[model samples]
Target: MSLLERLNSDMKQAMKNKEKDKLTTIRMVKASLQNEAIKLGTKELSEETELTILSREVKQRKESLHEFDKAGRQDLVDKLRAELAIVELYLPKQLSEEELSEIVKETISEVGAKSKADMGKVMAAIMPKVKGKADGSLVNKFVQQHLS
Candidate 1:
């Protein structure tokens, strides 16, 4: 099924189950997808574009969680955490640390990345491969660790 169809089905299930948090997140996702379609003058977004949107949504939630934590707002932190969980459901299974390390090493080798100056090239080469499957900050750290 297409991402839109899957989201529509999940929206119905969430409504029936009265899962308010999940329902809200799913609705926002639908709205975002529709907005993108309208912006591009297209009827629907591709699966890859949908995945990008989902990844962005999750990243926003993670950043919000961090900010809430820093501000000592436990309530917002918990809320964002719940929302993040809902957003994560659509993502593929995440890579393990060992797997991430291997990918990073491969990317470095592929890009011939040496020293900190080549960070951008390494990142550009790897992000397409990692994207929704791995955390950006973790990947960045690994890149730095390997490069430095």
Candidate 2:
């Protein structure tokens, strides 16, 4: 099933099971999807678009978790962790390091990125292919190391 359909089904299940945390997270996802659809002047969102939104939500939660860790707020950290787990349920599986490395190498070669100066070009070229599958910063770092 499409991500949105799956999400809708999960939302109903959450409601029926009285899973408060899951329900909240699913509601947030539905709202985010609806907002994006409205912004794009569309009645429905594509699976790729929905994945992008879900990835952004997961990324935001990860950043929040990091900040909570930095500030030594265990309670907030724990909450964010739980929310992150819920958010991650909707994201595609992450790429492994070896897979990412292979892509990075191929991207560098394709873009003819000989030095760090070409990092942006290589990244721009590779991002569309890597989007939602790998972490941006990790990809960038790998690209930089290879190019430099």
Candidate 3:
């Protein structure tokens, strides 16, 4: 099923199950997708575009989770953690560190990226290859290690 169909299905299920937290997360994602569609003047978004929007949603929650944790807001931290888990359910399977490291090394070679100075070229060359499949910071760390 397309993401919208899946979301709608899950939304109905959540309602039936009376899963408030899950229902709220699903609604937020649906809203984000709809807003992006409107912003882009498109009736439907491609799979890649949907993934990008979903990734953005996941990133936002993760950032908030970190901030809440640092501030010692246990209540908010737990809530954001739950929300993040619900959101991540829709993301592509994440890459293992070893797999990510291998890809980064290969990309560095492919881009002839030889030093920290070539970080930009390596990242530009690799991000698309791993987009939606790997976390950006992890990818950057691997790239830095390989490049250095």
lDDT string, candidate 1, 1-148, tens digits? 8888888999999999999989998899889889988998999788788888888888888888989999999999998888888888888889999999999999999999889999999999999999789998999999999999
**Model 1 segments beyond 4 Å from truth?**
none
Q: What is the lDDT of residue 67 in candidate 2?
A: 91
Question: Largest TM-score belongs to which candidate?
Answer: 3
lDDT of 3: 0.92
Candidate 3 residue lDDT tens string, 53-111: 99999999999989988999999999998998988888889999988988998888888
- Where is model 3 poorest over a 10-residue stretch in terms of lDDT? 105-114
Question: Candidate 1 or 2, higher lDDT?
Answer: 1
* lDDT of the candidates, in the order given: 0.91, 0.88, 0.92
Model 2 lDDT-worst window of ten: 83-92
**Could you list the CA RMSD of all candidates, in the order they appear?**
1.2, 1.1, 0.7
lDDT of 2 by residue, 1-148 (tens): 8777888999999999999989998889889999999999999888789878988998888898899899999999988888888888777788998999999999899888888888889989998888888888999888877887
**What TM-score would each prediction reach against the true structure?**
0.94, 0.94, 0.98
User: Considering only N, C-alpha and C atoms within 3 Å, which residue pairs clash in candidate 3?
Assistant: none
Count clashes in each candidate, considering only residues at least 3 apart in sequence or on different chains: 0, 0, 0
